[model samples]
Target: MTQLPSAAPTIATEPGQTEPAFRLVAVAIEARILSGDIQPGDTLPSETNLAETLGVNRSTVREAIRALEQNGFVRRETGRKKLFAAVPQSRDISRRLKTAMVLDHVTFEELWEAMFALEPAAARSAAQRRTDDDLAALDANLAQMRLALHDSDVLTDLDIAFHHLVALATGNRAIQAARLPISELFYPPFLAVISRLNAAERLLFAHEKIVEAIRDQDSRQAQDWMEKHIQDFQRGYELANLDMGTPAALPRAGHDKQ
Candidate 1:
């Protein structure tokens, strides 16, 4: 097992210069996780040990761990006493950020712009690198989406899964990691738009075309088709009477409870 760089000391400086003790610790721990020094499911050092090692107060260590847990870097096992480091799923990051966006009222236009920038690049990569397994996964998700036309919950899950499959097909872990949260944030509002437009068939048709392009390893076609497909959803949202200037709302607790 490789060791990560030691955590840096937390220092007080002028405002905007650096984060306080807790944030610094959190960043150091996150770096270890990203670098694979702290593998998923590994136990972190006890709070007292970490505090002593980092020359910080135990309260700072506690705050850092709380932040990490909130971000899905660490989770408490059910009925278990210890906290453990974990690999974060894209859903985890998206959920937190999307929640913040909802509270801050981030506009649909902002999200659409971000997607337009990211998805086509993902499509191009997937076309070049997708394997048979990746194609099969996409096919499976498409099938689920087809069956889920009337089932909003299923449709929503498959929608996210479809993009996740694309990211996986790209064979770039960094892209996959970066893409997940954005894709996750994109889907619920998209599902809302789809439901409103009665446009399930059209959406499925576009998905099929995109999948075929990836299956055929046509990078340019995949990129172009994906961009169009994503843009089409934005159009659907507008056509469905959604205010593009209004931020997409977060799902309330007990909403879409799946």
Candidate 2:
């Protein structure tokens, strides 16, 4: 029964302005959430209550709530009528961006350039900040990687997981957020390189070097190893005769991890 701020929104309209009243209502609610006047998990007022408070029609309130729900600012349990205030998570936001990237058909060269800037920085940060738990997880990943060297499909999935773990080890949410969307797009090209060049051993070697540097807290060595590893990928792609300028693709069904 937490009440919204008592003041009605002051929505200004210019002559013949086309902005919908529902959007203004949605923005008002989002502003309150962002400003911490309301918190995630707080129960939102009923639509009627909201409409009364905002001096809007009930239908406008419903539309505004729909917008908030779509943006991840509100939610209700399955089979429940009560909406709760919420914040958008990075994963949810990143998933949308990932979908857009796929639909836009971004190039492998574009993906490569982004990873070039991000992965080495992630490795370096992981080396500095990684905990014993991070090392153990990485050790487990490497073990699986060694066993999967000849299995290109499994190895590619492991390769994706390995980089994800490195990003997690960085203890930087921003890095993790930015990396998640781009990570899945790597699967197709990675699989091609490993399968075509039989480059699993080289991949394993680079991973080992990077992990060793991370375990020893040698940030520079970790970054150098990662840079070389990523560079080797481009070489493998060229050797495999794949076009880097070609639009990247989602991993084919049965190729992605469950």
Largest lDDT belongs to which candidate? 2
What lDDT tens digits, residue by residue, belong to model 2 across residues 1-258? 566754455543335657788888888889989988898999999999988877778998899899999899999879678999999888778767776787798988888888888999999999999999999999999999989888888888888889999999999999998888887786556666657787788889999999999999999999999999888878888887888888876656334421
Each model's TM-score, in the order given? 0.70, 0.90
Residue 116 C-alpha lDDT in model 2: 89
Query: Residue-wise lDDT of candidate 1 within 1-258, one digit each (tens)?
Result: 223227454332335755777888888888999888888888777777777777778898899989888777887779655778887766655566666666687777887888888888899999999999999899988988888888776776777778778888999877776666556667887776677667777778878988999999999999998899888888888788777887666556536221
The collision pairs in model 2 are: none
Error of model 1, residue 145, in angstroms? 3.2
Model 2 TM-score?
A: 0.90
RMSD of each: 5.1, 3.1
- lDDT (C-alpha, whole model) for all candidates: 0.78, 0.85
